[model samples]
Target chain A: MKAAIFEHAGKMVVEDVAKPQIQAPDDVLIKVIRTCVCGSDLWSYKEGDHKQAHSMNDGHEALGIIEEVGEGITDLKVGDFVIAPFTHGCGQCAGCKDGFDGTCDNHPAPTNWGGGYQAQYIRFHYANWALIKVPGKPEDYSEEMMKSLLTLADVMATGYHAAFCARVKKGDKVVVIGDGAVGQSAVIAAKMMGASRIVLMSRHEDRQKLALESGATDIVEERGEEGIAKVREILGGPADAALECVGKQAAFEQAVGVLRSGGRLGYVGVPHEDNLNLWELFSHNIQVAGGSASVTTHVKNVLLDAVLKGEINPGRVFTQTYSLDEIDQAYKDMADRKTIKSYVIVD
Target chain B: MKAAIFEHAGKMVVEDVAKPQIQAPDDVLIKVIRTCVCGSDLWSYKEGDHKQAHSMNDGHEALGIIEEVGEGITDLKVGDFVIAPFTHGCGQCAGCKDGFDGTCDNHPAPTNWGGGYQAQYIRFHYANWALIKVPGKPEDYSEEMMKSLLTLADVMATGYHAAFCARVKKGDKVVVIGDGAVGQSAVIAAKMMGASRIVLMSRHEDRQKLALESGATDIVEERGEEGIAKVREILGGPADAALECVGKQAAFEQAVGVLRSGGRLGYVGVPHEDNLNLWELFSHNIQVAGGSASVTTHVKNVLLDAVLKGEINPGRVFTQTYSLDEIDQAYKDMADRKTIKSYVIVD
Candidate 1:
């Protein structure tokens, strides 16, 4: 089998690797069909040790067709098309039952059993909880529709989680920071939740256009104080809520700064800083919520319907696609900010 | 005139000072009838410079009788009795109108014109915005009732702000960290909001008793992991919400640790730490809210009615009282943790 292995900082390679097999009773062996490079993958690509002599898994988002199912599986069968979220959960845990599947008590942390999504084959444990089956046959959907459906696994779900956790309601003036794919998804999520207006902070011309298409009513090209100033000037006041998709300190500060007093700030970014000043947030009466998204079967189902109905086209976030052999170039393009997100078609 | 001055760390003195007079068009000169020491004031007393030559104002929670009013004053008369919150806000500002009085754009920060509530006479700026009328003549209420009413200015209001911001609904299992006056006030606030069970973390017998009297149904004296263990053991699981009344890092961590997934943590204590771990908070989907309480005219009015109706007795938090001459003793006793809170009867 061919798999994408993270060789070291600024380096990735597609090489022959052992194929995955079902180990757990509920495990499902899937033939990888499509996977994409996430912004978070850039963190390890930029700083991981180059001389560590270790090859690690390369992706967390992917979709595939089930090739085999373990004995315990009941709801799903062979050849089912399913999407795998960035992280998996056990379906029966209290956390999973309550919709926080990301923090499932049964599978508390990410394990290294399955190499990565950018592989030809992978074994997924807790298949019943981790895999969301697509409703129709693969032949029923166009390539564009399939791409949009794939986003329900992580990016779109993450974006929706931000709006959901912040409780974005109708008539809310929302500000989404970051021009990344997830940020674009948040703009759509805010709109889906009936936010009256969405201010997207994106400096790039390409992302700004996508943001507007994703339901952003306004775009602020400035960053930091200048960006916040532009947003406030456009809105004539602070936004009722802000979704921080960039985990940098300055981005977090800007997100909080542009919010009205008592406004909610929902963040889905993997934080890069050790701490955020609680004093600043405290003085303004801002509430901070949202962590790693708990995208369960329910959230995926809703988003899948929206994608199928063409209400939201999150697939636009994937601006570039590459074959498994071009994996290194895909990583380089995403890391270099030359693309919003890169898709790796592995089938 | 006489006032309590913060001379240095661990030093306070009541000395002769210039009497206050109206300086602004909206200022009002008031004779401070009652004042109480706040937990926040202890920070300056314990760590302030020892060799600093200048003395500073020391109290922010007080009630008084209006002695004079500026030309702009209309709704309040010279003989009206009122209580001043620790901070003031312009009633016309968007922040204030939204119930975030602490972050009022017109008056964004706390000012020093009043020279602290320990003074015999203090000039309050933004008189209409800073002061809340007691709704009756001074002679009509007992000293105890006045003391209780004073808590509406800060402690009780702060406690209520925590529960309010956390959105404590009926039947919630609430855990309050810290047994200080504000924490005790939170216990009362949670109960008033109809929480099914209130768990108070207090080690001292006196504070525990006060917490129980204030509506705490259970007490967990253990601190840190032990404390969390006991709480979970008692509740059969993590609490639905937690009120962090203590500003220490461990206290905040404990509050977040004891909450169930998706639980809310409302904090009113002035944070002593620079940052809270976003990683831990993100994983659990816990929402953190409550800052320097924006207890506006609306919140105060509602709490005042509750206090007046004998629905809650926040005044009991004032465990001891002292005259202006004994101001130093009051500071020493509070710094030494001998009293939950101290009151100064300036009249």
Candidate 2:
């Protein structure tokens, strides 16, 4: 099997690796059908988080056909088309029961790509709980677009989950920070959740337009204080909730600034810097929270079902796509913002 | 009118001040019926808050009667018994619409008392929105207990709101930090909200028992690290929602430590300390929030009505009472933790 592996700091390679085996009775092996790069992958990619311990396998958003199922894998069978939920999680756990599988103690994670953005074959534990059968769609549906839906395995779910965490409701005024796939998807989720007033803060006009089309009622190009003040002015007060999708410290502060006192804030951005005033949050009574997207916990099968039903068109998010052999270039393209997202055809 | 005015840090005296008059068209002159001390009052009394420029009239909660009403005040009239909702909010404002009136710009405050703890009278502005009529209660309910129930004006409402903000649901496990009146009340409120698992952390066995009786299924007589471990041991994992009622760096961290990854936290205790690790909170995805309780929004009236209707008995919170002349002794009693709450008889 050829897999994308982290070889050294700031370097990655698609190398031939030993095929993964189903070690757990509830595990199954899936032949990679499609995979996509993620922002979370890029986080440690440039700085080498797990590089010291072992080769880090790169991608988390993936889909494939089950090639074999271990003895205890009853819900699925060989040749079942499926979307591998971003995290390997037991369906039952305190965190999973609360719809937060990313924090589940029973979830198994890869020693390295953990079957994420890999090629050929990989083993998945808790297969019955972790893999969702990809629902059938119209014959005209694009396979490339369906592959893009793989982002829902993580990014899209994250954005949707972030919006849900923000408690976006009917006729709510919401602000989404960041223009990445997560932020864009938040615009969609917030709309779907019935937010009448949606605002996006994006410097990119193209992304801004996309956000508007995705149900963002307004856009603010300003950054920092100016950006926040603009949001307030536009809304006549701070928004009901601010979804901080970009995890930078400044964006966090800005999200805090543009919230009405007692408003909720759901953050999905991984912070590049950590200095923030707790007093500000305290005085404002803002609920601040962010971490890894509990995609599996929230909507593992539902999002794919939505994709199959065509209620969501995630394929548009993939501004670019590549063959499995061009996976390295896909990462660079996503990193450089040359592509909003890139799909890798593994089959 | 004579008010207990701030002469300096630790120096407050009953001084002659002009009685407040109804200025706003929707105003009422309320001869203060009852007032109690709150911890924030100590800040002003000690001259801790930097913004204390005025001769600070301390106190933030009180109940009074409508002695007079502005010409346009149709909802209130002479001799109408009411609890002054400290937040003088114009019910029409956006902040008011969101159920947060304390931040309302047009909020008229206690010009007569500055806040709640004081002597004589207060002019309630926005009387329509700033006061609620206290319904008749059983003749058996003692005046002493009634004073404690009046705490619904702030502290009690605050405790319940903390749980409410966390969206605490029936059968949810709750962990409450802080054994003060607010924490104790949170146990009661969580019980009323149908929480099946309530854990209270307090070293005082008496408070622990009160916690257990107040609906805490378990009690952890430890603070900080040991306290969290004990809670985890008690519940297998962390709580679904943790209410932080003791505001301090350590208390906040302890609150964070006891939550399952997606746990909601409502912090009502005002923290004197500013140091809190933003990274820890963000990484854990613990929702952190606090502000002056919007007690006037819904809680005070609801709790009061409940008590009056015999739906609940919230008066046991009081442990001692003293005549107005014994104010100094009342402070000492509460400060020494000799009482769960101390009341000063004014009439």
Candidate 3:
């Protein structure tokens, strides 16, 4: 089977790898239809690499068709188009029952035997609970719809998690830190939740335009304290809620800095720097929340219906697309700041 | 005027100080009827002192009578008894408008010219917004009621702030991670918010008893990892919400550790240690919030009514009392852990 393997920093190669097989009764083999290069992928793409020699492919989001299902699966079957959330849960663990499937006690990410979703064939564990079955086969949706569906697996749902955790509500003034796909998606989510003003921090013109179209009411091209001042100036004060989609230290500071005294912050950026100052949040009466996105929960409960109804076009975040053979270029384009997100059609 | 001054480490002296006068149009002279030794006061009492040769009194909580109202005062009048929240706000700033008067922009605590409330007479600034009227004279209420009213000024309201920030909804399994007056108050607040189970972390029999009486359903005496294990054992899993009242690093870790994957933590302890690890919170999907209590907001909107109706007995937290002359003993006893809280009588 062909899969995109992380060769090293500054390198991603599509090469032959062993085809994945179901090892558990609850598992299913998914033939990938669409996947993408995540902003998080840039972490390994630039500094370190997740894979050593002959290691599995590395990706987390996927939209695919089930090619085979194990006997223990009760609700789903083969040939069904589905959206596979990056983190699969057993659906019965305490974390799962409490609506945090991303942290399922029975199936932590490290225990998964399946290779990454940036592959032609991948085994999805806990298929019965983790996979959200689409309404029809792959031919039922257009390329744009397929892209949106793929995002529901991770990015779009993650964006929604930020807004949801921040408790964004009607008439709220929102500040989104980061202009990546996830940040753009957060602007959409905040708008959907009735935020009166949405400010996107972006210096890039293309990303800024997409964000504005998605729901951002304003934009700040500045960074650091200057950026915070701009947000406050635009809002006439501090914002009600801040969505942190970049994991950098400055992003965290910017997110915390632009909020009002009793404001809330929802951070989705995978923390690469330990820079969150509890003292700041404490003294200012700020509420801080958000971890790994509860992808399956949001996808099944919100994103699916919204996407099906065309209420949101999160797929617009993918400004570039690639074929399986062009996987290296996809990573390069994103790492070089040439694309908002790289959509990969792998079927 | 007589006031309690921090002479040095392990010493408190009640000495003559200049009588306070209304310096601001929004200020009033308060003839303090009751004040108390706060746990926070011990911060200065043990390691350092807050006063030099003739510094103002060292206390924040006060139940008093308005002896003279400023020309700008609108609602309060002379001779009216009131509960003066430790932190006063202008009531019109963005912080106050957002229900966070504790962090009011126009009148941060450093701008306060009034001596501390541990004096016979002190100036209460932002009088119209910060002082909550008691509906009658100080003598109209019993000694116990006065103690409870004094608690409303800071301790009780702070505990309520922990619970409020934790979002302790009905039927929640809660963990109160401190056995002091604030923790006891948090237990009461959690109960009022309809928590099904309240677990208090305490080693002291007296505080444990008080907590149980105040609505704590369980008590974990162990500290650190053992404490978290004990709480999980009692609750059958991690808690839904945790109230960190001690503000120590271990307390924050314990509060965060014993919570379920998506649990909420409300921390009220003045952070003496910068120990909040954002990575831990990020990985666990936990929400952290709380700050200095919004004393004025809580006193007016909830505590006053509850205390007046005899629905709560926060005064029970003050197990010992001392006269103005015995102010030194009050700090000594509390510092030695001889009292849950120390109540001082003045007029």
Candidate whose TM-score is highest: 3
Please write out the lDDT profile of model 3 over residues B4-100, one tens digit for every residue. Answer: 8877777788888889899989999989889998898888778774446445556988888889989999999998988888888778867778777
lDDT of 1 by residue, A164-213 (tens): 87789998999999889899999999999999999998878999999988
TM-scores, each model vs. reference: 0.93, 0.91, 0.97
Best by lDDT: 3
Interface RMSD of each: 2.4, 3.1, 2.4
Residue-level lDDT of model 2, residues A275-338, one tens digit each, is 6676676666676766666666556546666666777776667788787778768878888788
Better of 1 and 2 by TM-score: 1
* Order by TM-score, highest first: 3, 1, 2
Candidate 3, position B332, lDDT? 89
Q: What lDDT does the true structure give each of the candidates?
A: 0.82, 0.72, 0.86
TM-score of chain A of 3: 0.96
Candidate closest to the true structure, highest DockQ: 3
RMSD in angstroms between candidate 2 and the native structure over all alpha carbons: 3.4
The value of fnat for model 1 is: 0.65
State the lDDT at A186 in candidate 3. Answer: 96
Q: Candidate 3 — which pairs collide?
A: none
Candidate 2: chain B TM-score against the reference chain B: 0.89
Tens digits of lDDT, candidate 3, A1-347: 99998888888888887898989999999999898888887888887745474455568888888999999998998888999888776778666777777766566554232337898988888889989999978898899988898889888998998998899999999999988989989999999999999999999999889998898999999999999999999999889999999988899899989987778999989887875676787778888998878787888888899999999999988889999889889999988989889999896
lDDT of 3 at B338: 96
| Model 1 spans with C-alpha error above 4 angstroms | A49-54, A91-98, A110-115, A297-301, B49-54, B108-115
